[model samples]
Target: MRAVHHLRGAAAAAALTLLAVSGCAEKDGGGGSGAIQVTASDSACKVSRTEFPAGHVKLAVENKGSKVTEVYIYAPGDRIVTERENIGPGTKADITAEVKAGSYEIACKPGMKGDGIRQKVTATGQGSAKPQDPRLDRSVAEYRKYVQAQADETLPKAEKFAAAVKAGDIEGAKKTYAVSRVGWERTEPVAESFGDIDPKVDVREDGLEQGQTWTGWHRLEKALWTDKKIGAAEKKLADQLITDLKDWQKRVGTAEINATSMANGAKELLDEVATGKVTGEEERYSHTDLVDFHANVEGAHKSYELLRPVAAERDPALAAELDKQFKALFTLLDKYREKGSPDGFAAYDTVGKDDRKELSDAVNALAEPLSKLAAAVAS
Candidate 1:
């Protein structure tokens, strides 16, 4: 609670600094209408042009792979400009996105996954700034509010969870741990925007190096569930996680949000579920992977909802179809919910391979529709 109050006070104090620059970013969005042709296969990622002036860049992606494929345009910092996914063999689709002047990679994922074959493209000159798309601007505003709300929800839960551990109430901490993860999982993409905070707050035990600061959720999880004790050092780390959460919210609130980011983040959250939760690898100690999975879905759904109107305007049927897919995915997930609440869900080890497969299939089902979102809504 103190953390939340402090965040509100800090936010109010910095209102002028944050809100003054809050509206549409003066970013050099790709507003150009010219289409760049790309061809994808098992061995290659080929593009019609190596570079174009930064503004609105359109791509016509043709997947020649025997298996399903995906293509992405990545900026220098591994930021996703845009991507098109689940293109069947011999299928073609258009991907459009706004890019600033920078070096980028056009990557083709041939077998539907892997570090893809990449070709470099450079945008040399600043193309003229066209007016920001009002729909995208509205989506960005809504996303910011969503992130802020998630952040606000995060601090209090985190504080209580941390306090439980520090007080050596192991059972109480176990109960609170799943409850606290909702905001953290939902806003993970937003939290990861700041370079250092995400690692500090969420990095797994396997990720830690020799003699580095052992903090964040997983470290505490290991202590509570594995070691079955929280000593002075672990207690200190618990307190630090709360303080970091407070600082984390302040930094993320001021960062920019746009269509590509929102769409990419939604996809990334699904990927997070696939890579960690579905694999039963994330909550290795507690086996509470379903909690994170549900939270990620909630976050991704929010991101999609932010773009719903624009997607509806672009193609009404596509929008409606996506809505149906989302509903179906939630229905499938609901069966896994413990006591029919989002906060409680089936333990990871309790789910057999068959159960995991069904969840995976549902996720993949929703992912195909979601993969189209960024490209569809791109200006």
Candidate 2:
């Protein structure tokens, strides 16, 4: 897994070379209002323009693909400036991102996996010269602190989980697995921005690219529970997990964060819940989906709360709707918790069809309004 990390970084560099060789055209500036258009099909990603003045940029993405898609604005070295994931087939989403004047790639992942198809574009003419609102600035500052705190808290728990794995204590490792992930789940987007850490630590089995060794929590998860044994390979992966997480911890403060990204990140958490946690795919072995489900909601709620001051000022109706939806979702999630145990929820497999539908509906309700948050705060 340690070697796998460096290899992925090399692959990103290779992808950059391919982007340049493929003739990514340049344009100075020319586009109208109402969000930059991005068409995502199975085989192609077409952006409306190759360049634009970039202060607060919005990409209006419509997926024409048969598979679900994800869109990202990545700076060089594959740093994610901002991204919108889980854009289902034939659906549309608006991604509002704050970009400084620089070179970037607008990448579309048709199946919501891999590095994605890249289209090189530049942001021109002093893109972020306009000073932001003071409230927005506070939101960014508080959120940055929150991200650092989550990272700080996550590392210790992950270390404990790793210790259990290395000791060949399967039950001990299993007990700490989901708990270790809560901090990471809460602030995943911030960790993911570093470009290379996420795949090493969080990439699921199906999410792996060709020849990419399956590592991180899920890999160890299968070992402790499904495989029912811990070998040298599992022990090595345990150490690698900590190594990757420690890297994330040290770099959390340095992440490129802004007001819109915070708003977008909150929404991304909901998308994470919708696609992975809610689907029962994220913890296929441990059946700890609800723990992750709670953490994702907590993270999303924190981001929304931090940004609420400005978001409410911009669109009070939207803000009110979000407050209501968030409360409703929490209320629904609480019903599943074991008596007297705040963190314990019924294993996902034991969750009936009706209950799962209720949870899914609540997420959808919150997600629809949450999606508009970036625009509200950006305005």
Candidate 3:
């Protein structure tokens, strides 16, 4: 499996292109009352204030680093309320979010990589203590349960695949490999939520840290698909994967949830599709990009479904437009599926360049409508 480290950079570029497309219709400003001034440099993440009155807030971010940076307002439990991305050096951008009274974190990624430097921020107000958007709350809670269920499925299936490798059965491991990824693909954000474990668990060979032992899915993937043999080292990699995923399962069991997370998680899922899955980069070894593509769509659709009520309640026309776009994307995806995969998805190689470009266009269209979702759900 090739290292897919380029996905984040590519996704950031896509986000910027969309931002420019939308900004053509308007201009950004200092924002309204309670706008927090944020500055990012190679060394630090700074905020104008650590406390706010709660409710609607804006993060007016300035990037001073040489590299591209993005700022995120994170709620408790790794939930990011809002974020502004693709801010190059000397660039200014802002993200407005409806934040309730609670503890939060602000993270700045100078190179658009890793967890980033973080600062703590809080909002204080009588209303902040109370739950906002009961409907959205239910949606987030239900989404978390969905994540838990996916985790439950992922752990054992991964174990089973690992078991095959541990037995030195390369064919058996390859047979179960795609099935093992189903849970992890559906609940990717949860894997990403755990600070460092994510890299150890999912980092591709190209993504390995210097001097760090490569013992995860991609490492094992190479053995099964490239080497066509599972050695003792490969078996040990399998053991480590199980170890890390077990931690992933435990951490997600106690994880937090909110409407903002649901909105962003949906975007992240689509970003996965646009960045790696669409290009057939993620499944370089197994040619299983279609499997991941379908899973990403499924996960994104679930996230969008959870936030549909809030968006619809705010703007019926926009909601209908988004629903139509969603169906259009899904209808295109439907053609690729048949009696094949464990989930009935054909391989990524089945699609030609023209079909791939068409699918990519569909993802971009959906992203435009999906970008407005967080604002519509905002209080």
Candidate 4:
């Protein structure tokens, strides 16, 4: 049951003031094809080049590990410049990110846990900060506003869920549980940027670090559904959940967001769905995986749509492919909806193997094209 998704989280960092969208192209300095080669094995992380010119950089990553792995480009203070997750064994990806002149680490998290193996590198020379396109500016602003709105809507729903738990109403808490999570799931990339908040509010039991207390939504979820009772401890945790989420609500305004991050974040949502929801690891007890699945798709689609104008302008073919894949995935997901269900989707546990396979296939289809989004917008 300890899938690759159980261990994903990010720390907080200041907003990157530099404006540059990502697109794969020829290397700025003297390098072949302009992509830094990254090889991630079980024991080591290797980068072909130690440094590159600031502006747009590409890391062509290959996972040689036996287990799934994720790669992150962290600025000096662990601020994520850009990252690619759920790179399964023997797979490869070309990740494009915007970087300024500074030191950074290319980290490989094999098995998707812990501090990750790091490779130090520097962004030499000046960064490309001039506005590439006015459309991208609009894209960033609109995405930020959308993230804020999701946060604004989440607080009230989470409060209601907390209240229901405190009042010792199992059925009431269950009803509100998936509803409260929709907003958070939709904008997890933003929410996860705050280092201390994500684990506090959303960490799964298996994802917990040693000595870390399990106190988020999943903890309470187990109590409500599996344990089937809310005692004093559960009530206290309910209050703690609200406090932690409110911290996330307050910090949403400060998250590091950019055109590249938005594009990367959209891809991250698909990773979340593939690793966690599609596998039935998330929302395990309540079987609300589909609810989370829907939200993840919605969030990813929001990012894609906002960046569509620019993406389409840069690469029309990729844009059309993305539209088709997104529609196909959404259409498949729509088949699972149920009017009688609390979350408007059939229980995940009841989903047949054939159906789950179909869902996973559709997600993979969308993710493959979606992965190229950063490079498309970069142009």
TM-score of each: 0.75, 0.83, 0.76, 0.88
RMSD of each: 8.0, 6.1, 6.4, 3.5
What number of clashing residue pairs does each candidate have, in the order they appear? 7, 0, 1, 6
Candidate 2 local Cα displacement, residue 212, angstroms: 2.1
User: Which should have the higher lDDT, number 1 or number 4?
Assistant: 4
Candidate 4 residue spans exceeding 4 A from truth: 1-10, 15-33, 63-68, 76-81, 86-91, 109-115
How well does candidate 2 match the true structure in TM-score terms? 0.83
**Distance from true location, Cα of 83 in model 3, Å:** 5.3
State candidate 4's TM-score: 0.88
lDDT of 3 by residue, 33-64 (tens): 45688889988999899988776566777888
- Tell me the tens digit of each residue's lDDT in model 2 across 1-379: 1111222332331222111100001121221364578899888999988998866676777889999987776767765545566678877766545556678889999887677898999878765556679988888788888888998999999999999999999888887888899888788534444447778887777767678888899899888888999999999999999998888887667665666656665766676677678778888888889988888888889889998988898899999999999999999988888864334777788998888888999998998888778767766
Clashes of 4: 6
Cα misplacement distance, residue 158 of candidate 2 (Å): 2.2
TM-score between candidate 1 and the true structure: 0.75
lDDT per model vs. reference: 0.70, 0.74, 0.70, 0.79
Candidate 1 clashing pairs, residues 3+ apart or interchain: 29-55, 30-55, 30-56, 30-98, 31-55, 31-56, 32-56
Task: List runs of model 2 lying over 4 Å from the truth.
Answer: 1-35, 42-44, 63-70, 77-80, 85-91, 107-118, 339-343
